[model samples]
Every structure is written in structure tokens, then in C-alpha cells.
Target chain A: MSLELIKDILLATVPLLVIFPSLFAFTTWMERKALARIQNRIGPNKIGIPCTRIGLFGLGQPAADGIKMIFKEDIVPRGADKLFHLLAPILALIPAMLILCFLPLEFPWGKFMSGQVQAFLLDSAVIFFFAISGLATLAIFMAGWASRNKYSLLGGMRAVAQMVSYEIPLVLSAVVVVMMAGSLNAKEIADVQTGFNWFVLTPWGLAAFIVFFVAALAETNRSPFDLPEAESEIIAGYFTEYSGFKFALFFLGEYIAMFAISGLAVTLFLGAGDGPFLAVAPWLSVVWFIAKIFGLIAVMIWLRGTLPRLRVDQLMAFAWKFLLPLSIFNILLAGMSHHVTVAYPGTTAQVVTWTVSLVGMYVMAKGLDKISRSTAKPREYLYAE
Target chain B: MSILGGGIFKGMAVTLRNFVGSYFSKERFITTNEYSWRPESELPQSIGDYPKEEGEQLSDTTTVNHYSRNFPMLLHDTGEPMDTIRCVACQICERECPPQCIYIEKSTEKKENADGKPQFYPAKFDIDVSVCMSCQICVEVCPFDAIVMNSQFELSTPDRFGGLLVRRDDLLKSNDYYHKIHPQEAATRDERMAADKAAKEAKKKAAAEKAKAAAEAKAAAAEAANESKEDTE
Candidate 1:
């Protein structure tokens, strides 16, 4: 890479680093506000200047929270392994930040010239992004083990188990997209999704997209799957020993993962950088991209508010028994379809087979729903006066 | 099945609708009790000022001027009239009251009144109504059942000190009022009283039989002693 290429990388990477932190902060506010409404209570409404008599929307709450978190005495447990304890949060945060560097914000920087050399840099670039994000599990495990708390240890163990289990499905889902676009690179994948027919329109693409989205939710340690925090039991999980800005880093890491995953979802499943047609501005694609990602983030928040965390056993079972098999099946089917299409060229049998398989999948799913309903025991209630 | 996308489409559609709906209005999306929207007329009397039109409507039901009688006046439920509560000046309720809200003064009358007996009536019975927690412990432990919680929860006051303090007559309500406030509890208590009455009658009958047997045995012993004395003579 030339100096101009390096400068372009910096330009892209630095702005993201700055942009993502603020995005994390705003997402946190959205989650809190949404949760408050769900649980039928006011949340964080006491902060900010009163509009003479009323606080008026509590606009300054996030600022107040940030200040409070900063001032909190940074606590380090006496029994904790001091080096790993200090290292855990940073470990957890870095890979999440690294993910931002690889996320295909746009196709790429077009062209760069350094001194005597001239070259075309990818409007879309490298395939290493997914592999780097996979390393976030190590940080999580390190945080869990280093804390010297049993809850932390259990949480760490669950984190490893969940990440490792779901990672297969997560990767397999990505494989469908990779196979379709014939590129390991995210930007290339986004490039394949331009104009009218985004890759998400394809059968394999749709299946992979849903699987990837669900896997991302689990990957981020978000609610409905946030057994790691298990407030009722674990008391804030792996970050139990962390406080102040160090704690904020873990907080930042979670939100950034949320942003990165949603960005990935939009790119893969939805039209990556496409917006509604308008003659006025082509740049609205960026706005559309941001909106779609934010929309995904809001659903995560909604899930957090509405659903209880799945039991550890239930989560593991779902991953291994259901997601793993389906993901494998999806991968094999996508690979076979691609291979046959290449070999036969114009055979109509491939489309017929695909259609039949889809029909079979729908029937099986409906049957399962029926079985689930029939087997579900009515909730017993005590009507004591 | 292909059209439905294996139920995944259905699932996605539900969540997509939910996602879109969450943005527009959370209240519309949310299914929850609307306690705040309940009309004031339907609402139970609150801690603050009772809504005026409802209060006036309530006031029209009964005309009780016992408040102006000065010596601890209590309102009847109907508000049409005031009935003097038959308090025998037993300060047991006052002493047992947890909040120390209830107060009583008792002085014996030298002259016997209409009941042909002289005891004492509460000269000044006062209960600081605002301080009462409405726990009804005073009502529960009262041997006389003289004090009771009323359905008239509209005990709002402008002044915390003077206006809120309910005097003896103010706190007092009729027996019928207690029956209205806690009908089921009163009915249960009455059932228990009848049972107790039946148990007492059976116990009395058994006692009388035992006494008669003991008397006959004693008489036989006396006759035997007299016979022995006559034989010795």
C-alpha cells in the first residue's frame, strides 16, 4: 500500500472510531428510553435543566449518566489477577473497535497516488474483517476468567460456549453470501448487491441473512440471550470488577458490536448502500444505510425490553441442535446450487429442486409450530383472594 | 409453503411490523393498563383534593350537621343526617391505636341517664384522620367495635393540622356503615358468634346434668351416714 492509500485508510478508520463511540452513546439512550416505556415507568427523566417547571423530555440524561460513570471510584477486586483483570476490558473492547475498520462503510476510496506510484484501491477491499471480529470471543473469555468471581467464571464459560456454538452458524451464514458473490471481502459482497437486485433477493441470501442477524444478536451478548449479565444471578457478569472509564470501554464495546453487526446485516441482507430513488441527491444512500442500521439497533432494544434471557442450557441446545444443522444444510444447498448451475448451464431442474426444497422447509416448520402449541402446558395460576 | 418462506417470512413480517410500529407510537404498539386515563369520577378517592363535581354529588346524598355540633362530630354515610355514636367512653380503641391519632376523655356522670345506669360517655374523642394509615388495626382490636373504617375515603382536608384531625364524632360511624364497608367480614363474624352461642348452650346443658348426678350421690352418702349412726345408738 502507498502513502496515499495509508492516508485514505486513516481517513476512513479514524472517522469511524470517533463516529462509533457517539453512536454507541445514542444507542444506549434509545435502549433506556424504549425499556422505560415498556416497563411502565419513567427513566432518566431527572437530568437536564427544567423548562421553568418541568424537566421537559430529560434531554440531558445521557450526559448526566456519562459524568456519573466517570466520577465513580474505579474498583479493582482484591482477589482478582491484577494484570489480566486490568487487561480483560481492553481485550474485550479492541476487537469490537477493529470490526469498525473492516465494516464496508461504502464500496471504498476509489484511487490513491503516493510519490511515483499510482494504483486503484478497492472501492471495496479485504476479506480479513470477519476473521478479526471472531477474535472478540477471546476478550470475553479473558474478562470472565480473570475476575476471580464464580459468577464471572460461569459467565465466562457461557460466553465461550455460546460464541463457539453460534459461531459455526454465523460463519456458515456468511459462507452463503461469500459463495454467491465469490469473494471473502465485505466490500465485494456489497458491490454484488448494487442496483435493483440486491443479493438478499436470492433464496440462499435470505436464509443466510436471517441466520446471520440472529447470530449477531447472540454474538453481542444482547438481551433475550444476555445470560452473561443475568442481573438476577450474576450481578453484572464479567465486568463486575470494572468501574469508571474502564467499565465504559466494555459498555462502548457492546454498542459498537451492535452497530457493526447491524451494519453487516444491512450490507448483507438489505440493500447495502441503496436508498429510495430521488433525483436530488445520490448521497442519500449513506442516510438510508444509517437509518437501516439504526432500525436494526432499535429492534435489539425492543428485544431487550420485551424478552427474558434464555436459560444457558436452552441457548446452547438451540445453537447446537437447531441453528448448527440448519446452517450446515443451508451451506450445502447453496454450494450445490452454485456447483450444478455452473455444470449444467441451462437446466430447469435446479430451479424445480430449489422450489421443492423451500416448500418442504415451510411444511416442516408449520408442523413444528403445531407440535409446540399442542405440547405447551397451560400456565397454572393461583386465584387466592 | 414456498410462498410463506417456511414460516420465516411470517416471523419476519411480525417482527418487521413490530419494528416499524415501535417508532410511530409506543403506546399504540403497547398493550397495558391505562390507569392514568381513568376518569376522575371512576377513580377511587385520592390522597389530594377529591374532584369537586363528584364531591358535590356525594354531598347531596346525606345531610349530616354533626360537624357543627362541635364535640367530635362524625358524618353518616348517606350525609342526610347525623347519628350519635354509642361510645361508652371505653378508651381501649384510643390506647391501642398505632398512630396515636385517636384520643379520648372519659368522666363518670353522678346522675344516671336514660339507660338507668351511669358509666361515662367520651366528652371529647378525637382521631387525627390524616395520620391514620387505614390499616384498620384499631377496628380489629377494638373490643367494643366502636371505631371502624368507613367507605367514605373522601377524607381530604385543606389544612394538614386542624382540618385533617378527625374528632370523636368525626371518626364515629353507624353499625350499618361498618356492615356496608365490610359486608363479607361482618357476615363471617356473625356466623362465628352464632357458633359460639350454640357451643355455650351445649356446655350449660352438660354442666347441669353433671351437677344433678353429684347432688344425688351426696344425698345417698348422707343417708348412709345417718343409718350407721342410728344402728350404733
Candidate 2:
């Protein structure tokens, strides 16, 4: 029984450990190349296949970077809390790696197991995912406090504030999906979003998805919401004191978190693994699922290249004033639409709900924008004219 | 009415156009290619296979436009660069140089210029390129129309102090090279110089004719006076 348990554990974890990190490496290269292209410059076209004249468009760059990062000198400040400082990157990396298992990605290899197996199949998987992911904030705070640097501490503080503020809307927006799906199980959530019944197609679903995506961007410390590690304001935020492999760990953790969040977004909406030709080929579902995640990642990259980082005030205002209330309103709309659909169960109900929610969300969004704008007073300097 | 998040979408569209157009329209999107390597032509496939010789690398890589200017070089008309050199060791350019990078030592003896005028030449001309600001003041203040900006910018070398101080022999470049590098500016300068020379020659010829006419009239008057004296006698 213990052997079987060990076998099950290996089956569940080994693939995730192998797949996601490699994906992280590839994503780094892709982000660099894509950003370079957007800026009208060629990036990293020097390093190619080793010991050969043929250039594979600098594909070997990430490997070279990894090797360099590994061999770099690891420095620890004399005044730093050596234990916590060392513990911080591992802490940051754990939750991100841990959360990847919660994604309902079924593999063809699962057939070899005696029964279907997942890493952690809790009844409240979505809640568990959120609960674990929140630990990343503690890691950030620990890293900041342990670093003994003002900028690192400030970054940690900013990260905590931003992540805490944005988490509300992120969870609230996912609530729309949980409400509609009638289950907290990630597998069930994904299963419910089959065929053309994607939650994003509905009005409340669309509103919640937008809110959720924006909140996710903030949660991941992505640009336009990247105040925690604002290079101009704070030197690399919580990881200011980190170097070498520890720094690489933090970097890996951040990108993996991005993947995990984007994965969650795909499962929540976009009909996870629901694409054409699934009947003839069952394995295509995995491809569809990963493809959807990539689609969201591509959008994130595009947005990162397009938008500038928001100021602290602007970031706070956006989360509290705009996304929070909008998501709350969406929950109400979603509940109403759900009941109406159940009672009538026809084209009429869907049509009415779609129109009312669309118009209602638009008006609410505009009203929120006006209210926020009206209330914002110009900064009053104490000493300056 | 203006849409709320429309600005973001517009910005995204602009970036998307740039990202896509970079692959198709090299001239319009990819501006750095002109400064860097070209994949199709002389660029080696691998970094390890890059040209080893400095001259080969520079010749293969550096392609500055005609308008691009660097440090000043002395222009000579033809034949030996030192013999036909236009610089007369004039201190005007040296004085006018903002950074005082140009150093000139006038030759004790004089040489005949292209115009057959005895003029002092720069015996030990040197320019510290490291100190040069490339302000073109030296080119502007050169009364002989000798110093003009060179387009060769790949001047990096390991021997710092000695390498950067360009000597007279290295500074002297033929007028044909000047024309090749900057055809328009050289042509315009040549035309202006030619016009000035023609005007000077014309003025000189006119003065000679006037002097001859004065001398002939004086002789005629003398003869006439002599004849009158003889008639009186």
C-alpha cells in the first residue's frame, strides 16, 4: 500500500516538476525575443548551437544564462539574517511550484495508474489553491525583512499591499465561475466548461473574467501593476539581496506563478480543454489546455510591452474603486442570471440576461470611472508652491 | 464619446503593427540593421566564425552614410599626399579648434603649392582623436580649405595613447578620397575655390594691362616733349 502511494505520488509530481520549469526557461526566451521584436531590435541572436557554425536563432541563450546564473558568486550581507535570507527564495519558489498541481491538466499517461490520480484532489481545490498561493506574500515579506535593506523592505511592503488588495477581486471574480459551475473542484469546474458553455460567453462571466485577468496581472507583479519590484523606485524589490542560484530561484518562482495564474484563468474561463476534434483524439485535450494557457500568456506579454507601470495611488484606486465593486456587482448579476436561466430554461432568458448584464456592466464601469475621477484631488505639497 | 480603455487598445495595436511589420518591412521597422550585421550577406552564421583581422572586420562591417562625419583629415590635390597637401601649416584651424586637439609644427623651408606659391607645410602634424569633440570647427576655420571631416569612425585600438594620436602621414588623405566620401561638399568647395582663383587671375591680368597702358602713355608723352624741345631749339 505504501509502495502504491509512493508510485502515485511520483506519477502526480514528476511531470509537473519536469514540465513547468522547462516551460519557464522557454517563456523567458520567448518574452525577450517578443519584447525585442516589438521594440524593433534583434535580441540574443549570437549564441546558438554549441561547436557548430549553424545559428538556431539564439536558442541556446537560455542554457547559457542558466549556466552563468549557476556559477555566479552568492553573496550574503554581513548584517542579514542568514537563515531567513537563505529560506526566502525557497519559500517563494515552493508555493508557486505547489500550486501548479491544482491545475486540472489530465495526461495520457494517467492510464497506467490503477485509478485516476492527481497531485492534490481536494473537494475545495480552488480555495486550497488561493490559500497556498497567498503564502508567496509571506515569503516576500520575509525576504524583505531579512535582507536588511530599505528598498527590499519597501518592495516587500508594496508587494504585500498590492497582492492583498488585488486578491479580493481575483477571488471574487473566480466566485462567478464557482457559482455558475456549482462546484469548487477544479476538475469539475473544467469539466462543466465543455463545448460552447464557457462562462466567459455570458455577461457576468465576461465582466468577472476581465476583472480576474487584471487582478491576476497585479497579483503576478506584472508591469502596469509591478510596483513592488519597481526597478526605478526599488531595486528588484524583495530579491534585492538575492544573487546567483537564489536569484534564479526567485526569477523561476515568479514566472511559474505567472503560468499557474494563467492556467487558473484558462480553467476558469476559455473552456479548458474544450476544442474541436476531441472525440476522435482524446489526447488533444491536453494540447488545447496548454494552448489556452499560452494564449493568455501571449496577451500578458503583449500588455507588458504596451502599458507603463501604474503609480502607487493609481494601482490602489484601480483595485478598490474599479475592479472590486465591479466584481461584486457581477456576482449579483451572475446569481440573478443563474436563477432566471433555471426558472425559464430557454433562449429568451439567455438573451435577456445577456443584454441586461452587458448594458448594466458598461454603465456601472463608466459610473465607477467618473466617481473615481471626481473624487481624486490634486496632490498638495506641504513645502512647495 | 471616448471609450474608457480605448487608449490601451490603440497602443497595443501600434505595438502589434511594429512587431509584425518588423519581419516584413526591414527599412521601415528595423532601424538597427543598418548599424549591425546583415544576415544575408557578409555576416557569418556563427559568432565563432567572425572575421579575425581588424581591417577585414571593419571593411565588412562599417558602412557609414555620406553625411556621417568623424575626425578631420588633411586633403591633398594629387600625387604624393605630402607634396600635394593643401595645408600650409596655418595656425587658424589649430586656434579655432574647440578642444585644441590639433598640433602643428611648421616646416623651416617652404614648398611650392599647387598654385606655384611658396607656402609653409605642416612638418609634424598630429591630432589627439581622444580629445577631439568632432565639432567641425577645425574644418570650418581652415583658410587653405585643407582639413575636412573623415567618415572613418572605427578608430578603436588596444594601444590607447599612441594609437589615438593621428600623425601627419595618417592624417593626409587625397582630395579624390575626400570627393569619394563627400562628393557634394567637395564639389561645392572645388567650384568656390575655382571661382576665387579665376577672379584673382583676372584681377591680376587687368592690373598688368593698366600698368602697361600707363607706361606706354608716359613714354609717348616723353617723346612728344622731346620733339617739342628739339623744335624749340
Candidate 3:
């Protein structure tokens, strides 16, 4: 019985560990190539198949980078807290990897199991995912404080502030889904939206999804919201003192967190593995889940390439004044929409609810934008003509 | 007044267009493809085969246009570079160069140039291209029409100190080569040099004729005076 329990646990957790890190490697390559194309430059086309001149469109670049990162000298500052500095990357990575199991991705191997096998099948799995992912902020702060560098400290503080500020909208937006599904269980939430009824299809769901995505971007420290590790401002933020494999760990942690958050986004709104051919071939759901995650990741990469980083003030204002109020209003709208759907269950009722919710969300968003906008006064030049 | 965050979508659309357009339109996007590596056959052997058109996209290291000027090269008329070298070793370019990258050692004995005029050749002419700013200052200061900018920019070498110091022989490119690289500029330069040469020859010829006429008149006057003296005696 004990051995079987261990086996089931391994079966549930092993694939995630094997798959996501490898996906992180591929994502780095894809991001470089995509960003290069966007800027009209060829990126990493030279390095390819080893021991030969034949370039395989630079696919082997990630492996080469990994080797380089491993072989690099690990540097530590004299005044640094050596133990915490060493522990920080590991700490940052743990929460990110821990949250991956809660994504509600059902594999074909689950059928062979004697009992239902999941990494952590909790009643409040979504809340647990949020609670664990929030620990990544502590890791950032630890890295910053341990480094004994002012820039690193500032980066740590900014990350703490940004992640904390954005977490409100991030959780609140997911709350709409949780409320709709009538459970905080990720699997149940996903199961409720089984057939073309993705939460994002509805008006409030769309608003909630938008808010969630924007806040997710902040949560992952992805650009426009990537002010924490802002290279120009903070010199790589908390990991400024880290070098070699430690630095690589931080990078891996960050990308893995991206995958984790994107996966959650898919689970919450994109109908988690629910696709057209699910009835014909049940196992294709895994592919559908991963594809949806990749879709979100692709959009994230596209946004990173498209948008510039927001200023400190703008980032705070965006999260607090804009996303905070908007998400709260969306929750109320979602509640009203839910009651309306229950009271009048017909096509005409559905149409009316959709229109009213859409219009209401739009008006609220416009009002929030107007309120949050800071009026800039024209500059008066005294010396210059 | 405007829709909120509409600018982000518009910007995303522009990037999307660029990302997709790069694959189809090689000329409009991904221009580095034109000048990167290519097969040996397409690569230029001499300056004649080099691309001279204003915006002609080629697939070789020699993918340079007419207006793209780099470091200075000495222009020779024809035949061997040393035999027909245009530089008189005047050191004008060497003295006038902003960075003083040019180093010239004047020959002890004079050698006849392409025009059959005796001129001091540069025995040891070297230009440290590493120090050259590519400002075309040496070309501007050169009165002999010897120095002109070469369009070849792929000057990377393993031997930093020795390889970058371009010797006199390496610097000497044929006039035909210059004409191939920069047709319009070379044409105008050649025209001006020809006109100057012609004007000098014309001035010399007129001076000789006037001197001969004056000598003849002086001889006549002297002869007339001698005959009159004989008659008086």
C-alpha cells in the first residue's frame, strides 16, 4: 500500500518536473527568435548542430547557454549573507514549481491508477496555488536583502510592492471564476466549463480574464510590469549578487513562474484541456491544455516585445486604482449576471444579460481610466526661447 | 475621448505585420540576408565584379554601394601598382590626416610616374587602419589625386598590430578599380585632373613660343645694330 502510494505520487509529479523545465529552455529560444524577428534582426541562427558547420536554425543555443551558465564562476560579495544568498534561487524556484501541480491537467496515465491521483487534490486548490505563489515575493526580498546591495534591495522592495499590489486583482479576478463554478477546486472549476462554456466567453468573464492577464503579467514580472528586474534601472534587481548556476536558477524560476501563471490562466478561463476532439480521443486533452498555455505564453511574449516598461508610479496606479476597482466591479456584475441567468433561463435572457454586463463593464472601465489619469501641466521654459 | 489602451493594440498590429512580413518580403525586411554569407561564385574577385548600383542588394561580403566609402586607398593608373602609382610621397595626406594614421617614407631616388614625370615614390607607405577614423580627411588632403576612400569595410584580421597596418602595395588600387567602385566620383576626379594637366601643358607651350619670339626679335635688333655700326665705320 505504501509503495503504491509512492508510485502514484511519482506518476503525478514526475511529468511536470520533466516537461516544464524543458519547455522553459524552448521558450527562451523562441522568445529570442521572436523578439529578433519583431526588431528585423536575425537572432541565434549561427549556433546549431555540434561538431559540424550545418546550422539547424540555432535550436541548440539553449543547451550551449546552459553549459556556459554551469561553467561560469560563482561570485559572492564580501558583505553578503552567504547562506540566504545561496538559498534564495532555490526558494524562488520552489513555490513556482509547487503551484504547477494545481493546474488541473488530466493525463492518460491517471486511468491506470487504483485511486484518483493528483499532486494536491485540495478543496481550495486555487487559493492554495495563490498562497504558495505569493511566497516567491519573500524569495525576491530575501535575495535583495542578502545581497547587501542598494539596487538589489530596491529591486526586492519593488517586487514585493508590485506583487503584493497586483495580487489583489489577480485573486479577485479568479474569485469570479471560483464563484461561478461554485468551488475553489481547480478541477471542478474547469469541469463546469466543459462544452464551449469557457468563463472567458461571457462578458464579466472577459473583463475578469483581462484583469487577470494584466495582473498575471505583473505577478510574473513580465514586461511593461517588469520594473522589479528592470535592467536599466536596478541592474538585474535582486539577483545582482548571484552568478553562475545561481543566476541560471533565478532565470529558470522566473520563466517557470511564467509557465505556472499562464497554466492557471488556461485552467481558470480557457476550459482547461477542453477542446473539440475530447470526445473522440480523451487523451488529446493534455495536448489541448499545453497548447492553450502556449497560446497565453505567446501572447505574453508578444506583449513583452510590443510594450515598454511602466514607471513606478504608473505601475502602482494601474494595479491599485485601475485593476483593483475594475475587478471589484466585475465581481458585482458577475454576481448580478449569475442571478439573472438563474431567474430567466432562455436565449433572450442570455442576450440581455450579456449586453447589460458588457455595457456596464465598458462604462466602469472608462470611468476608472478617467479617474486614474493624471493631468500633466505644460512645461514653462524660462531660459530657452 | 479615445478608447482606453487602443494604442497598445495598434502597436501590437505594427509589430505583428513586421514579424510576418519579414518572411515574405526579404527586400523590405531582414536586409542583413543580402550582405551575409554566400557561395564563392557570387562573391566578387576584383573591384569590377563588385556591386556598384545605388541600392543593388547582393549576397556577398563585397556587397557595397557607390556612395559607401571606408578607409583610403592609393589610385594607380594601370599595369603594376608600384609602376603606375599616383602618389608622389609628398606626405601632404600624412601631415593633414586628423588622426595621423598615415606613415610615409619618401624614396631617396626619384622614379618616373605613369605620366613620365620624375617623382619621389613612397618607399614605405603604411596606413594604420585601426587608428583611421574613416573621416575621408586623407583623401581630401591628397593633392596628387592619389588617395581615395575604398568601400571594402570587412577589414577584420587576427593579427591586430601588423595586419591592420596596410602597406603601400596593398593600399595601391588601380584607377579602373576606383572607377568601378565609385563611377560618378571617379569620373569627375579624372576629368578635373585631365583638365588641369591640359591647362598646364597649354601654359608651358605659350611661354616657350613667347620666349622664342623675343629671342628672334633681339637677334634681329642686334644684327641690325652691328650692320649699321659696320656701315658707320
Candidate closest to the true structure, highest lDDT: 3
Q: After best superposition, candidate 3 residue A266: deviation in angstroms?
A: 0.7
Between candidates 1 and 3, the one scoring higher on TM-score is: 3
Q: Write the per-residue lDDT of candidate 1 for residues A1-385, one digit (tens) a residue.
A: 8986577656656667777787777777777776765554455566667355456467677776789889999887788888888787787788777766655564233222222111223334334546667777887778888888898888888788887878778878887777787776666666677774676676767777777877888988888788777787788887777789888878888888788778878877777767667246655666677888998988787667656678787788668666666677777777777787778777596786577556554554455445544765766667422
Off by over 4 Å in 3: A115-117, A374-385, B29-233
Model 1: residues with Cα > 4 Å off, grouped in runs: A1-6, A49-56, A107-127, A278-280, A339-354, A363-385, B1-233
Model 2 pairs in collision? none
Per-chain TM-score of chain B, candidate 3? 0.74
| Model 2, runs deviating above 4 Å | A378-385, B29-31, B34-233
RMSD of each: 13.1, 11.7, 12.7
User: What's the lDDT for all of these models?
Assistant: 0.66, 0.87, 0.88
TM-score of 1: 0.60
Q: Give the share of true interchain contacts found in each model.
A: 0.00, 0.73, 0.62
Q: Which candidate is the best by DockQ?
A: 2
lDDT per residue (tens digit) for residues A71-188 in model 3:
9999999999999999999999999999999988787886557555457788999999999999999999999999999999999999999999999999999999999989999888
